[model samples]
Target: MKVPGTINSRNPNSQSVFENSFVKTLSIAVLMGIFLVDMGLGLFEIFSTKESPLPTAVVLLIFAVIFIAGMVFYEKQGLDTLSSLVGGALAGFGFSFVFVSLVGGVQFALGGGISTIGWDQVISAVAASMIASVVILKALSYKLQNHLY
Candidate 1:
């Protein structure tokens, strides 16, 4: 007999601990932390070196790895592709915006007076984030689906 308010360990339909929403949220939070660290470090590198290509490449590589890992994690949890895509995009945009603002604030503190932030820059960051999210989600979903079966 199943006890009230308690999960049945023998129940085949019962989800594992990792399949719970709490785990999902925790995983996403971890991914976001990774994203922020990667972005902050990448920005520091670019600013310190005054060279763009190498830093950009390194950042993209880090992003790609995280995206794939996130997608795989979500897939294992039975999350749909659309949800993953939207979640990834939102996380990316939010982090990117914060990163940009933080960089601007640091610059202001370092003798560069506060300047108006252009809407174009914000829009571009959002657009780039969304594009990257979509591409990563779609490609990973396809690969995961085929590999799982």
Candidate 2:
């Protein structure tokens, strides 16, 4: 069994750098997709003048719950590490969405009516979540490779 490395080089599929990187890259892409879709819905609610922050909060909460269920299901496939990254990203997006839609709405609810949920915040949150997920999962995956396989 190989010891853990900074990056995941523990692809049980093949003992090659290319194979391990491919698996990690694919997993990262999946997590990114999940985050983008969830956050996009949150953004839609945030921008809708009639809906208010409540809808965005509800949507994010729903996503958080669903994400947990998804992880549980994926875990059985021996894909827990990949699943965890997706879960973390969903959480980050959910929190950022709620924070921007609710707390930032003070100005809008009061009158001057400024949108608190800017594209910048959404983009930054997505990037931050994706980056963190990759780092955390790569480290943990390398560590758990022996035990998992």
lDDT of 1 by residue, 73-93 (tens): 666778899877666555555
Which portions of model 2 miss their true places by more than 4 Å? 1-30, 33-116
The lDDT, on a scale of 0 to 1, for candidate 2 is: 0.60
Writing each residue's lDDT as its tens digit, candidate 2 over 1-149 gives 55677365565665765458778676675677445534454455457654555556666776676667666756666676777668656665665555555443443434433235555665665666777667777788889986855
lDDT at 40, model 2 = 51
Q: List the residue pairs that clash in candidate 2.
A: none
| Winner by lDDT | 2
Candidate 1 TM-score over all chains jointly: 0.31
Query: Clashing residue pairs, candidate 1?
Result: none
The clash count for each model shown is 0, 0
